[model samples]
Structure formats: C-alpha cells, structure tokens
Target: MRISLSTLGCPDWDLDTICTTAADNGFDGVDFRGYREEIDVTQHPQFTDRLVETMARLADAGLTVSGLSTSIRICFADKREENLAEARRYIPLAHELGVDTIRVFGVGDAEEHSLEELARVGGETVRDILALDGAADLRWLVETHDNWTSSADCRLLLDELPDDNTGILWDVGHTTRLGGESPAETLDAIGDRIEYVHVKDAVYAPDDENAKDDGWVFVLPGEGELPIDDALRELDDRGYDGWVVHEHEKRWQPYVADPEVAYPAFAEWYRTVLE
Candidate 1:
C-alpha cells in the first residue's frame, strides 16, 4: 500500500512547503484538503488559475496529487444544488491534476433525518453529480462519517449508486471508534467498494480539552487505540493496493500535535508496520 498525507494536517503550510515536506518525508502522494488558510482547493489560486505550475511543482517534488478532499455533503436536504455544483466544479480540476478520486461525505445527523431519508437524499445527490461531464473519469468517494459511519448505514448509500466510479473512502477510525464496528466486519460489508482509506488514531478521552463530542482525541498513528494494524492487515489480505492516507485533522482540532511532528511520525510508523 502507498502512503499519503492529507493537507488537512498542515493548514498553515503553503504549496511549496507542503510538497517539499511531503517529498522529504517519503510520502508517495499528497491529498489536498486545504492549503494555508483556505479550506476549498477549487477556490484556491494554486489549483484554479495556476494548476499547471502547481502540478509541475508536485512533479518536481516527486509526489502525486493523491486526491482532492472536498466538503461536499450529499446527505443534507438544503445543500442539494450546492453539493452538485461543488462536484461539477471539481471534476475537471481532478481530471487536470491526474487525480482519480475526490472525497465527499454523507454528513447526516440522525436527529435531523432518518437513515432512510439521508440515504435517499445522498443517493440522489451523488447520482446527479456522477451524471455530470468528466465525473466518469474520477471516483467520487463517500467517507465513513457522521450518520454513515456504520457499514450497514453506508451500505444504504452505496446500494443506491451502483456505478463503478462511485466508491467508499473507508475511514477505519470512525468505523471502529465511532460506529462500534470491527475492521473485519466493516471489510466484510463494504470492502469491495473501498477505493481509498483514511487512517487516523485516537483514544476515548472525555476529560481532554481537545476531545470531540464522541470523547475522542486525535493522536499520532500507533499512539492510540484505533485498530490501524488490523485494518491494514485486512486490506492486505484483500489485495488492496490503494493509497493509505494519514488524515491528521489538525485543521479542525487545533490543539493536537503539530503536523511537522505528527506527519513524519506516521510515515515512520507506517513503514515500520506495513512496509
């Protein structure tokens, strides 16, 4: 499995710094979640107007643009047009950058809508986005997050979009810690549809100031209780050869360890354990 790092970890790093750090640290690819203070790559000048230069820079650094991580939530009722527009905007950019996958989410809240409703909305949105031009060349991945963390719940959305171009971004941390599903069970349910993987580690710490509502605090890989090894073993057993992205979410949870420290640690651990 190839290892990649998400820009979500280095919100403070500019494009040059990002590519240099990724290359120097032995990352095979760089997943763009954000750059500097901008959260949307589509709106970022480096991607929109200066794409050729950006691609050249990455090539010079010996890194590939693994994927573009977008905040397009398909399961929300009020964001249908917004989400579709976001997908339409990114498809061509992804094609230009030679990226085959773009990460999206099914961010449904159970209190706001039933699982069935979320599935219906998310399915329709994804279908519409997939129908757009240039979308067929790229994979649109729905991550295991929010109400769709459970493999069973994720299956509802996956069943609706049977297109081969649409697949799951299996976030092992969410499935194990949040959805209460083992790596084996999650793989059993949606392993065939997984096109990408987001690897992170955390422990239940309600008392910690940085703890999310689930009482989980992000930690460097191999430093917490996420079943990362088991998940990687399962992926290996299945002959999965996709990118294993280290999703250090320092963009959202600022109190976590700096990316400068956490990113290299993950690279070393990943090589030691999986390479």
Candidate 2:
C-alpha cells in the first residue's frame, strides 16, 4: 500500500512547495487537483510550458504521482463536449507525467432519468473520451461522490464502462458520512473496481456553525467518527494495494487545517493504525 497527498489539501501551495511538503510528510506521491486557484491545471503553466521542469522537480522530491482529479462530468449531456475536451487535454499531460489514472464525476437529473439510464449515457461519454488519441491506455475512474456515493449506485456506472480499464475512486468519507453505507458494505459491493481511494474523516456536527451543508464536519483521519481502521483492515484483508490519498478539502473550505498540519498527521495515523 502507498500513501499520498491530494493538492486539494494545499490549494495555495506552489508546485515546489507541494513537492517539498509531500516529501517531508512521508508521502509517496502528490495527487494534483490544481495549483493556486487554477482548477483546470492543464491551463496552468507548470503543467503546460514547464512540464519537463515540473517532472524534474517532482523527481527531486522523490515522489510518484497518485493521479489527477478532473472536474469532468460524464452524465451531463450538456457537458459532453466539455468532458471530452478535458480528457483530450489531460491525456497528453498524463502520458508525460506517467499518471495512469484520472478521476472524474457523474451527474444527471434524477427526476428525469433512472440511475441506469444516466450510467448508460455516462458510459458512452467515457467510451468517447477513451477513443480520443492517447486515451485508450489510461484509466478513467468515477469518484464516489454526490449522487454516486453508494457503491451499488456507482456500480451502475462502473458496469456500464469497459471492465478492462474503468473503475471507481472510492471516497470513504462520502460513503459513510452521506451515503450511510458501512465500509464493509461498500467494499462488498464494489471492492474489485476500487483501484484508488480518498481517505478522510468526519463527524455529524449538525449544530456546529462550521459544519458542512450536510451537517458533518471534516476532521483529521482517525480522529472523527469515520471508520478509518475498519476501512484499512477491510482493504488489507482483501489484498487491496492501492493508493490511500488523504483528501483534505482545504480548497473548498478555507477554514480547514493547513496541509502542513493535516498531511503529516495522516502519515502518522496511517503508520500507527497499521502497526
């Protein structure tokens, strides 16, 4: 198993600082969500013109790339061109960075379409993206988020895609916190398709002013009500050897703990809990 840091945790950190902090915090890779305020990082200079230099710096920091998270929505018919374009942009960059997996999300009007129907269209969108030049070899993973948090529900999309290269990027936080599914239950449903994971902790803090819209507040891993230990044990028992990414959403919630505090703490927790 490997541990990595999501740049979403340190939204304001420059690429150089991201590398240094990840290396110092015992992370094996840094998952690039974006840099500074740029959500579409392919448009950012570090990934565009300075790619070679960027790769050298990441190598100097002794890091591997976990993956890239994209805001591509596969189920939205309105965003089909946008989805394919994002894939087109990312494929070459992914080839350069040696990243094999890219994260994506799915969306649909539930009132108008069944989950299976949404997944069908979403699968076609993914297939179209994969048909783009340099995309066949890369894996596109739909995250367990929003409407797709339930493993069974997510499997509708996973089942719709080609089995060889598509799968789920399981976000444990959402499955437990919002989807109301236990770690064991989630694994039982889609464990085989789980090639990547997002690890975070949260508690029902409905009364807290700082709580998220869902009445839950994010917390350091192993410190909240989430089943971090159970999740790890379940994965280990199943011979799962995927990246465990600490997805601290500092970009979305500016008030959260800084990556400097959260990253190392996750590393420490990962060590102690596993031991």
What Cα-based lDDT does every candidate model obtain? 0.89, 0.89
Please provide TM-scores, in order, for all candidate models, with all chains considered together.
0.96, 0.98
* lDDT (tens digit, per residue) of candidate 1 on 49-118: 8988999999999999899999999888789889988888888889898999999988876797888988
Candidate 1 wrongly placed segments (more than 4 Å): none
Q: Candidate 1, residue 270: CA error in Å?
A: 0.5
**Considering summed lDDT, which 10 consecutive residues are worst modelled in model 1?**
157-166
Q: Note each model's CA RMSD in angstroms.
A: 1.3, 1.0
Off by over 4 Å in 2: none
Residue 246 of model 1 has an lDDT of 94
Candidate 2 residue-wise lDDT, 1-275, digit = tens: 89999989998889888898889988999899988889888999999999999999999999999899999999887788989889989999999999999999987777898988898888899888988998888988989987798887888788789887788999988898888889999999899899998999887899998898989888888889999889988898899998999999999977778888999899999988888
